[model samples]
Target: MPDIKKAGNIPTSMLAVASLLLSAPSFAEVYVAPFGGYSFGASEFNIKSSGVGNLASDEEGELKVSESAQYGVMLGFTTTDPGDIYLLYSHQSTELRTGNNFSPSPITDLDLDYLHLGGSLYFPKGDVKPYVTASVGLTSMRPSGEYANETRFSMGFGVGVAYQVAPSFSVFADARGYATFISSDSTLFCNGGDCLWSISSDIMWQGQVNLGLKLTF
Candidate 1:
């Protein structure tokens, strides 16, 4: 397991601040949400190694993470009727296929994970609540090999609606856009002595939609 420090200091600082606010005297409620959904995106990877002498090198390829399963958990604190803060962790299993050829074999399994500190503003209307959320966090990309893994700064924005189903439980659906910023000369997908590719990109984006059950206390 890679250290959280590798993800950088910004996400850590935001989590600490949110934790402090959650412990304040005016905090109204604490809630837990478990969610599962589908995620899709076009995360482009550019080849950077000059000596590989392959057509794939020095060219751009897309990691088409399409319609993959994603799941997560959130721990939240509500301070007022319309305001809350939360920490979230999500895991996504995606298929990495060549951009040009959509083949059945040679499909690589990729894992995309995130940890975020976020806030939400809710509009309460009768028994339903609609909300908008934003977060800053860390994104980790791991391939199913001895590949070079990466952790980068990430941020997201989302909108959702929640319907109260019971006294202390609610069901919700959310859709969010998450992106990670990558630098040039980052190695990826390695094994044994040689790496599959090195990538250079300014940003990698993903779209996620989730259905969840929230429990309040």
Candidate 2:
């Protein structure tokens, strides 16, 4: 029987991705890109809605993930058209902080990862190509301590350019953004017992910029 709990979630492991890439069609042109970059920006999750009550500040405020470094890889093949279809996996190590002040100390540490299957359409002008990319995926949000990990439906979009340095290789960079859907009832990041944050928004958003080398074979 299938686990409904994981219906839209990607496996948190790398093995499934490896197998998919390894089994690509022999005649297809495959693209493997590994990138490193920084991630920033996100709206607040209302703690009041969380029903967790105030921790320190007397004023009402929202909680959010701090800016941090992120890295990931994209593995997929070129389409028949002027586009590339690929699987993207990216990770960011960051912290969750509360209050409007957003102090240096965080409420808890968190690791954020994205697993997506998407495609990009390119505009080729000479060896330099500009493209727009989009992916529909899931996010793995793992917070330290008693908070059990949560997986939610998310999607990403980007615009970037790839300058072909060689016939089979290229260097590229993109500015991308992600949005994760949160249920309206205000339950997220739950342990079998307690849950943290109400996440009142229908969607939580984050943006990133990545640069990497792509090899096509």
TM-scores, each model vs. reference: 0.80, 0.83
**Most accurate candidate by TM-score:** 2
TM-score of 2: 0.83
The lDDT values for all models are 0.77, 0.81
Full-model lDDT, candidate 2: 0.81
lDDT of 2 by residue, 1-217 (tens): 3453555655544455556566666666887899999999976676543443344333345778899999999888876668887888999999988776434368889999998988999999999999999999899889988878889999999999999999889999999999998776466677665555545567789999999999998
The 10-residue segment of model 1 with minimum total lDDT is 48-57
Question: Relative to the unseen true structure, what is the Cα RMSD of model 2?
Answer: 5.0
Candidate 1: tens digits of C-alpha lDDT, residues 1-217: 2354665665566557555655656546788899999887656665544334243444555444556789999887776757678888999887666554223344567888998889899998988999999999899878776667768999999999999898789999999999888776766555556776667767888889999999988
Quickly count the clashes in candidate 2: 0
